[model samples]
Target: MKLDESLFTVPGVRRGLRFYVTGPTPCPYLPDQFERKAFTHLSQAAPDALHHQLSEAGFRRSQSVAYRPACPNCNACRSVRVDAQSFSPSRNQLRVLSRNSDLIRRPVEPRATREQYRLLKHYLVNRHEGGGMSDMGFREYAGMVNETPVQTALFEYRQGPEEDSPLVAVSLTDILRDGFSMVYTFFDTRQPKRSLGTYMILDHIRNAESYGLPHVYLGYWIKQSPKMAYKKRFQPLEVLDGPVWRRLEEDE
Candidate 1:
């Protein structure tokens, strides 16, 4: 796969590798603001070190591209990661874990399955109706799960250890040199009591700590978005302050 030669014809081919910017789209996390993304393609030719660098620089991988918020007017969308070494689950989080003790987590290759897609559709219908991914078809979902240029994995949660236990949640995760980047996660929305979303994050934080990893990237944490506020719950959180990873103070 050659670099997109036409990209060099564009005015801002400034990076050693080509970078492209997406047109403005309505901000899904904020009101009355448009969002743009500056992204570069990820290729098998040399992506491992580049992927690690880009992630540390606040870029997120989606399929074959690594991108970050390029919105001209807003900087509220900060990339955040949980400090796995210093993290301590709050009482509520402990309760959530206790409630989900029956659910067994399984790690598998990043291959999309019909069962996962169906559960995702059900979750979207109940939890994120009309959101961007509400209409994702199986083909699109498969591409999302399988078209990675770097190492990736899927974590599935089920009811019990039995091979046929009901599948309840799935997380698409990117394996980084130092931590895990949670690309996306969806669960059975019907079981509100389960708090599956938080459970998955807790599980990741624990797993990363156990494996000697120090961070668990949680993507953009928009200050004004209630939906994104949850990312901050796993303290002590670190926000990408330009090139530095600093402690995001509590009550901030």
Candidate 2:
């Protein structure tokens, strides 16, 4: 059966079609202000052309949902991507890379696991207990891991005896034709010294380079948000400005 493309509507002022905006909710990145999002759905039948158009137009996808910036009076969130080949880790990043040298990485078909959910719950409780995903039930976690219409995988990082290594971290990523986008990542928060978060970004850079991909989308980078500020640390990055990605200087 053919999918109805008409059900897919582009919301914009020029089209005179109002994009539905959600009610004001506490901003997740910022401290107190409310945030609203304008979003559109992406059907399984949605072609690659439409997906590319939406992504280039500044929309982000998580699971099966695609959302764009529609802040009524704010535009703080900026979409950022890194030129994978040009990204060079700093001294601290190199230290992190060296620390995780023992762990092995493998990309597998995305799937939900009981152990993964447990780790995810611990990560949220210890690291982001008050955040939006803290209360996500196992089923919701499964949806997050398994719901996808594109090439996706979970990069698992494990340590020790090969057969008995624990799943220390997992990154959900979408493999685009030209680049890769990190949809989400979770790790054992107890291993603070390992700096698994930084390790994952570095690993993605290496992964992109090895696969001959040019860029790695790091999602939105909010300079004011501590949680997001780490993104800027990956020097020689490009920020999506208007319709183009502008590279930043060393001093920037």
Candidate 3:
């Protein structure tokens, strides 16, 4: 696709940064609607700084590309992040943390492993069958983990305190200047009650706090999408509105 030259006219974006719009595709979050995206490549000239600026404007990074929803007449996708310092886990969330206390979290380099791919495949088959990434092979999985322009790591959650414990869940995370961005996460489907998905977010919040980061970017929160509704469980959530990020009210 040809770059949209006019996009560079936006203030604060470097002169050479090119942007493009994707063709309409079926909306993954909403039924019977289509979706489009405005995206740009993250170049090495100043990748981290560029990523920080774009992320503050609600753009999300996937590999080396930064993108945001550009679908016409659809504004359901709202970028959200948790205020790590002020965030306090609810009683229920604390219980989830307690339940998963035995799980060990290991931060590994952004390289794919067979064990991780195997767990990913199992997760896709059970939780996301027929979805966009359900058909991904090990090679594609490797590309997803390894192809990044910014600092990234894999947080592997294992079943025990042992170093070689069975892998239960994994989170692909990006280390931002101000916070941690959770790119993607998948877990074993056998233990539904464990709520490993929620636990992972909680863990990231803790991790960010330990690193003295201010926020934990949870990606988009779609009001009508049940799959994304869980993001609201984290209190003091902030949502980017236009060029400003505001605290999300309880009723909102």
Candidate 4:
């Protein structure tokens, strides 16, 4: 596909930064549709600041690259963030927290470990079978965790406070100026009742509140995708509409 030079003119984007559009590919979230993306590399010139600016403008970081959907005929993907300061857990969410209260969360450097890869492998096989990341090997997994120009961390969740407890869940997160961006999260699929996925997000909300951050970027949310439906459960969700963010009402 031809590079879209017009995207370089976006405000806050530094001069000389090039942007390119990807050729159309099958859309993962929708049926009988294709998707494309506008992406640029986060070079050393000003990686952190550039990442923050692009993130606020609805781009997501994947390793050292920032990208946003540029589908020609569809705008189904909407960037969503949670208002952490004003967020209140509902009864169900509270229960999810209580259920996994014993799990200990530790913020570690963005380094890949054998345990994490093992958990990721299990998660892919059981939860995301045949998906894009299902067949990822250790080298690629390491790149996902370690190849970042912006500030990033891995929040590892273990069953207990003991130093040797087995890891139960992990979230690869980006530390943004305004909030934390949940780049990706995977958990032990054996314990469905524990609701580790929801718990990880809930923990991030509390973590953001403790850090005095106002928002928690949850990446793209497509209303028609069942896989993305869980994102809406967080109340007072804000979605990027054009250049502005609008709150999603409960009735909508």
- Compute each candidate's TM-score over C-alphas: 0.93, 0.88, 0.94, 0.96
lDDT tens digits, residues 1-252, model 2? 222222235422123233455677888888777777676555546434445556655677867767765666667788888889887788999999999999888787899988889999999999898889999999999998898776788988999637458999999988777778888999998889999999999999988999899878888887778878788888778887776679855554
Query: What would the per-residue lDDT of candidate 3 be over residues 1-252, giving only the tens digit for each residue?
Result: 344443344456666677888899999989999988889998668898888888887889988999988776778899999999999999999999999998999999999999999999999999999999999999999999999989889999998878789999999998889999999999999998889999999999998999899999999999999998899999999998876789999888
Report, for every candidate in turn, its global Cα lDDT versus the true structure.
0.87, 0.78, 0.90, 0.91
Per-residue lDDT, model 4, residue 160, is 82
* Least well predicted 10-residue stretch by lDDT in candidate 3: 1-10
| Higher-scoring candidate on lDDT, 2 or 4 | 4
Cα deviation of 163, candidate 1, in Å: 2.7
Q: Ranking under TM-score, best-scoring first?
A: 4, 3, 1, 2
For every candidate, C-alpha RMSD to the true structure in Å:
4.9, 5.5, 2.4, 1.6
Candidate 4: TM-score?
0.96
Candidate No. with top lDDT: 4
Off by over 4 Å in 2: 1-19, 46-49, 161-164, 249-252
**Between the candidate structures 1 and 2, which one is better when assessed by TM-score?**
1
* Sequence-dependent TM-score of model 2: 0.88
Model 4, residue pairs in steric clash: none
Give model 3's TM-score versus the native structure. Answer: 0.94
Off by over 4 Å in 1: 1-15
